[model samples]
Target chain A: MKEKIHIIKIGGSLIDDTELLDQFLDQFSGIKGKKILVHGGGKLATTLADKLGIEQKMVNGRRITDKDTLDIVSMVYAGSINKNIVAKLQQKKCKAIGFSGADANLIKAKKREHAEIDFGFVGDIEKKSINKKLISKLMKLELVPVFSAITHDKKGNLFNTNADTIASVIAQALSAKYDVELLYCFDKEGVLEDVDNPQSLIKTISEEEFSNLKNEGKLHKGILPKLENALSAVKNNVNKVFLIKETQLKNHIENHHEGTEIC
Target chain B: MKEKIHIIKIGGSLIDDTELLDQFLDQFSGIKGKKILVHGGGKLATTLADKLGIEQKMVNGRRITDKDTLDIVSMVYAGSINKNIVAKLQQKKCKAIGFSGADANLIKAKKREHAEIDFGFVGDIEKKSINKKLISKLMKLELVPVFSAITHDKKGNLFNTNADTIASVIAQALSAKYDVELLYCFDKEGVLEDVDNPQSLIKTISEEEFSNLKNEGKLHKGILPKLENALSAVKNNVNKVFLIKETQLKNHIENHHEGTEIC
Candidate 1:
């Protein structure tokens, strides 16, 4: 039997539309073998952070997660966002368990302290500590593992990791033979060649082409990270990545259309 | 002037009621000096676990936290519950930061694996590693620290710690002059001498009297650990403990009346 694994990256924007998320889960439920969900809670994290009076700072579209910001992000991503999705899935009759990087040392990370810039609580994964046995046990029970983009160091310090990167890492680690399809669901249809025009959605793009678009300022700041993440996933053995609109989730899954595919 | 600190335990039941939680926050805005919030999310955690098809178990009222359960609990406690409180506080114009034991190695712990029964992913606090510096830094910035009762082993593995115990530990470590109060707020009005009668609310009880009631089987299973925690806190320099209804929070803080005071 050819093992099938689908790694889906659900963006923070899609979380609000419960209907869309439900449709995505329903589609996921039909698929056989393992399915991993890597979710982004950037907008939700920021909303909660602002409500907590925690000042949020960003550099080049990435949140400069200080100690305070990291705390809020960890809580929103690993806590509320993870459980809410699990709850919704369970409501839809799908078994789903939420996890953070700290659980079973599933995602061990090393501190990435950039010398020139202070990236207070950022981490890079330590591959050896990734526990496949634990994941396999959960899969045998037919439970979907929902992950938050947070990792911990060997000394027990928690760090804020990029959701896209975390999803890519998990997909590669599982290595279930099927293409890891990362869905960076956003408000728009897909990556646009011209920001002002809706019809200019780039259906396909190579790494160089994406980089050129980035250099030309045609790609929006928010979409740049998603594109970078998509390319990284492909480079790291994830078969394909999709940048699609949230509303087009069902169509994208069923027909593999309505999004720009990066392979 | 003597340094003052307030240690408040916001019950899980209160958190479940969004309107009531907001009212509590409105009252909390009037509180002065440094404040620390220790929270519980057993109900939410169990709900998520059941939704995920994970069986929930308890031994002596403490959740039997296995690796998988620990993951879910961490998400609910440190992530969801902690962030919600912080966000609410922020909305009320208060500076709040959410934290677990993992960040800054705030609370160091050793695994408590006993001979008869193993408490998987459970830890006993190791005092030396408690990061008072982080708390002080936050305090200087006038940020309220919202804590989730999750600890980390020396090797960085996340463990489930009791919120009451964590509150007691922090209170003792800080050595603040203000009375440390553990408000074990629940659905009930207060701890009762007679379980059946609503009017049997025990107005006051010494440690010995509370133990006698327990021996007679009047003090029931649910309140045993709470009493143990309250007594432990009092013994460890926390000036006082209170078991109260969530509705009487403002009155309890202001007048120190309307609850069962344990000493």
Candidate 2:
């Protein structure tokens, strides 16, 4: 049996709140064993973009990354957010190193080539791109790796990528070497039966039950992608997956407390 | 005998031009043995700050890092500039990693304490703060380190620091294990005795001659601090320090070419 490694994706919304981030860091520090934290962009990037008069390109409500947008996102994601989180983790006694995928060629990506749309500098990560050897080396040194939503094509261009995708790709890639658990931690406690009711949390879901929830129109819209990411990890040989509450991270680590585990 | 390591500092002014930077990187990649590359900020940060309406804070003509300015600087230095350099180096086939000081607590700092000034986010790197073992490991793998001028206080505060100071400090710290050569490359080829005559270059300056030049007030005004930094590195036991032209990087590396070497 391989030693377990947790790849946790921290959602954008939880990062901007100082008090909550502090508490989250405090809890995250208690997680004993190897882990990695992947973080998404917060509202600050958009705000900076607006102030700079950079037009936001949205296609079907999804943001398109133009060259200018890529620069802003890189600044926000890899710069302030990544460094701040590393500092906070250090303060919490969790030694961590921040990385933009370009660093050490940790992730090599190909620019998104779509037939209809040009998503200027957005990249879809390539296969076998994760530097698992380097990562494993760092993990052995007991340093947590914190990654920003930035990647690079080895040819010489930076790309803005989705943090959750990066997390999932990394988990799947590492599954061969370690028993990996992919966790999507956000504000919600778990997958709720009723979207509005926190008390209507579902503790676990298998593929058969997940399809039933999808067919019945009972699954939360925001959680659809998260579940898909989790299911993909499971199918890819990751040992387990979870959709857990950020506030409950401490209990989840110490007590193996319940979250919406997907098998 | 200590192994040789070149800790080269690239001046900010040389970074913006693509053709020049590309050529410089190609030459840099040709360098043999262990190395590191530390870069300073360029006009992008100031331009971004101007666009964002963040006032530049200056104390007696020296830039002071207030919080808003620190945010912008981090975005420029650690974000686009750092990653862009990393990507370019990778394109040159020199595997490199970029860092802000907070990464892995590699360079812990303390917020500047002063009676006369409140440079909000400025930090002076603490002694014994360099992660020599981690850096040695990376060097052993032939991965060059590229550092941005941001250090954390370990208590969660990210700081804006002088890139030259960072280079000096790191060089001094690493001198015990390496015959370190600290290079500061800028636009000018070397220090010229007659400001208008390139042929009047001062190829070398000893400590005594340095004081004579200082007394004569013959050095260029802008180069004063750089020379001071080089002198301090020499004082701290760095094997050698050089101020050479970015375009002449290849010659300086392969031919034992002439530059303003401060001994």
What lDDT score goes with residue A109 in model 2?
Answer: 91
Q: How accurately is candidate 2 docked according to DockQ?
A: 0.89
Tens digit of lDDT per residue, candidate 2, span A1-263? Answer: 79988898997778989889889888888888999999998999989999999999987676799889999999999998999899999998998999999999999999999887788899897338798888888788788999999999999999998888898889989988998878889989899998788999999999999999999999978888888878877888888788899888878877775679998
Cα misplacement distance, residue B163 of candidate 1 (Å): 1.3
Q: Is the docking of candidate 1 incorrect, acceptable, medium or high quality?
A: incorrect
Candidate 1, residues B1-263, lDDT tens digits: the string is 45667777766777888788778777776677788877877577776667667886777665577877886787678786665566556556665656667654567677886776777888887435466765675466566777788776535367788777787778767655445555666666789877677699999878899878988888888788777877776777777678887777778788977778878
**Per-residue lDDT of model 1, residues A154-253, tens digit only:** 4546778878778767766665544456667677878888777779999998888987887888888778777877787677776667888766766777
Off by over 4 Å in 2: none
Best by lDDT: 2
lDDT of 2 at B53: 91
- DockQ for model 1 equals 0.08
Q: Write model 2 residue lDDT over B95-206, tens digit each, in one string.
A: 8899999998888888888887787899887338788888887677678999999888889989988788888889998998999998988888788788788888999988
What TM-score, computed on C-alpha atoms, does each candidate reach? 0.55, 0.97
